[model samples]
Target: MVSPLFITTFTLLFVFHLNHTSTVRPKMHINIYMYINMCSSNILTNDCLPPLNDENDFLPPLNDENDFLPPLNDEIDFLPPLNDENDFIPPLNDENDYKKFAIKIPEKWKKKEWIKWMKQTEEDWLVFNTYIIKKKKKWLARKEIKWKNWIRGMEKKWMHYNPHIYREFKSNTMKKSQSWDDTQWARWIETEGKDFMEIEWEKWIYQNNKYINEWIMNQWLQWKNKKIMQWLMNSWKCEEDEYWETWERSTIWEKWFNLRKRRKWLRWHNRINKETDQWNKWVKSKEVIYTKEANNKLLEWINEKRNSFNNWKKSFIDKWIHKKQWIVWIREKQNLPCTI
Candidate 1:
């Protein structure tokens, strides 16, 4: 959209320059006049013009999908396909499941030491079994003593009221007592004397250490394996955690070193400035004032409600005392009036 005046001025300058040069060389006059007319016509048509594409739009259109190379299918599954060899999760019952916990095995003991440890564990297990047996025996002896005392006490209680019943009970208990096992006694109590028995003798027998020891012995191996597995797992986790901590600390140290080389002073100054600004902002904040105002209003509301309730209660009690003339209120309330 060039101004017509600008175009006319530019044409006049071109013609004047050609005329001035032609006067010095009349032979070039015709050629110069033809060149001027050609230039003037090109300017009028606006054909000898600027480039079609701007600097930013200079590149050809990218219509090829291959040129853009659809961003690496990031969502595609990269994991290995499921198979029996790789698909199985290590089960707690699997013997090989203990391997995840075996990371620190070498750190804790050498091959020879591990062998010694195994031998020691075996010995300890045997000793523990023997101790458990002894404990069971002691517990059985204690239970027998307690059972005898309980029987004696029950008999004594009955002796004061019914000597005959106590005598019969005692006789039955004493008869074949030396040959009577807990199971036999249990059978006798359930079948013959269960109705007469005051105490739950069978329950007491089951609670005895003998039965408890039997159950413990049955599960001992599994329990030991679980504890060893737990120890191994904990050791492995602790080692792994220590490694992670070391890595994190080293990373922080390197970061701090790089920071010191670049903007340590700037960071420190910014931190101090931020802290001061935060303190000032806190001092100016209306949150504390608003909270206090809300609390005051809440307290006032609570006091008003309490006073209103107390006044209502007082008025109700006064009316009850003055208006209700019931002479037997206590008996009426209990609903248990006595008849004369």
Candidate 2:
């Protein structure tokens, strides 16, 4: 019951609408692509993006929904603009500037904060060091001038206070030289040339004998003891010849000779007493107080004398002197019989 004209018109309008959408869809896609390309290419221009209804509406989607945005504290928000001259971060190319900023860092910062600050400032420090190295010669020249001025001032003050410093310095140098002569050089000479030194000393003593005698007499007058002089003379004589005849004739030798004569007489008397005891049959022997060491020494000496006498006896027999004359000579010399 619908009119034919109305149905035809409705169908034609729907076909036309489909064809227009198909043709325009591709053009719209192409326009969007061109717009994105233009925006990327002119990103720094003011007209890069169409104005948005809200600035936050066009933000890219983030991976985490709760990620923190920048702090909006008044201190940060009200900071001078980045391009402002007053807020400009000066290049830390000067050493003083680097030290100033470095000293400003707090000592109590956490490790992560310290690391972050070091990473941020490392480039500036390197740049400042390079600048210093490039100007090193000029800096050193200035330092040298300052050092010379300070030295000159010190010298002037020293001269005002003590004008004898140079003389004292020279004296110290002489003392050092004298010390070397006294210690190291003297030691070297003593060690390396000892025989040469001994010969020189002998020559000196021979040359200076008159003076040395005078000095000895003066020393003896001061000491006033003949024993010391005797000891010195004995020592000198011993050094010349230890077994000299004069040394054998000393007082000690005389005392030893007398002791030996008494010992021999005692022995002969004891022998005579023993012979009489054999006849009388009851005479007791005398006791001598000899220490163990003295007895051992006496025995050794007696053995030595007995061996010598035996050697002489053999010689006498070979020479045909083992007669009555030899027996009488032995009795006179030792007071003992030659035979048993």
Candidate 3:
């Protein structure tokens, strides 16, 4: 039930208040590009204003129209090919470049390409070589430190418990002993003469010379024997030994002479009978004893013998020899056939 004049006056007062407030408040200087970027496509309409070309705007200026366009095919065609060999390898003027080149070497490169890539100027080669030498030294130093630490750890953990380690240590000691020259031997004898001589004598007493036949056949031993004969003749010992009959000057000599006589008799017996003596001393010295390689070789020889025996059996059966002497042949060749 409001009057028309009162309604008109209220409308005019509201409009005046809005105008006064707008004039009194500070103007907001928004970037036109920012507004465009933030404004959603769905909300943009014909009512939206065009962007202003204000130089003082806080937003960056727009690039030209050509900047957004793709390059022409003709322009690309005028440029060098991307796969050019020269373009692939950048110049290695410094150590850093050399390292990078070495690290980034392509797996698929041809030998020729690799050679070409590796080729460098004298100055560049020096730098590269220096870098490589330094790197290798550092690597070796680190490796040596790691190896020392590992050895220390192993020694602490298994030095007393491991038999293999003890054996290896003994083998190394033997090698070092065998490698000693006259001076080193003299020095060692000076320091540990009694203990060393005792150990050596014990070993000599326990073990016979396994290489006696080889030693007898050695040229140096033959020369020494001739010299000994000359010395014996000059000293008149040869004349004195004429009625000795046996070279048994001492108990040791008599024992060795008896052993040699027995061995010679056994060897003659074996040759005459064409039978092997199982207890022959030379059998142990032969390469067929107590080693992995020897065992393998023995197995192979046995297999060959077995195969030959089988072939011989087949032949004997075809020839009707099996009917006549089957049991005898089988008994003779049961262990390892001499004929087959």
Q: By lDDT, who's the top model here?
A: 1
Per-residue CA lDDT of candidate 3, range 179-220, in tens?
A: 555455445334443243334333432332223223323533
Name the lDDT of candidate 3: 0.38
In model 1, the Cα lDDT at residue 154 comes to: 44
Q: After superposition, which runs of candidate 1 have C-alpha atoms over 4 Å from their true positions?
A: 1-116, 158-194, 209-340
Structural similarity to truth (TM-score) of each candidate: 0.25, 0.14, 0.15
lDDT of 1 by residue, 170-215 (tens): 5444335446655654454344444444233434444553455455
Tens-digit per-residue lDDT, 1-340, candidate 2? 6564554555456445544543233444454345455544433344422343454533443444232234333222223444432333456776556544332222222123324533544454355435433444454355446534643553343222233434633323222323353344334323432333234334533443344334434443443244224432432223322332333456765536555333323333453354345423311110111123324543454455446434543453333222323223334345564552
Error of 1 at 207 (Å): 3.7
Model 2 misplacement above 4 A: 1-121, 133-137, 161-340
Q: Please state every model's RMSD to the true fold in angstroms.
A: 31.3, 51.4, 40.4
Best first by TM-score, ranked: 1, 3, 2
Number of the top-ranking candidate, with TM-score as the measure: 1
lDDT of 1 at 92: 50
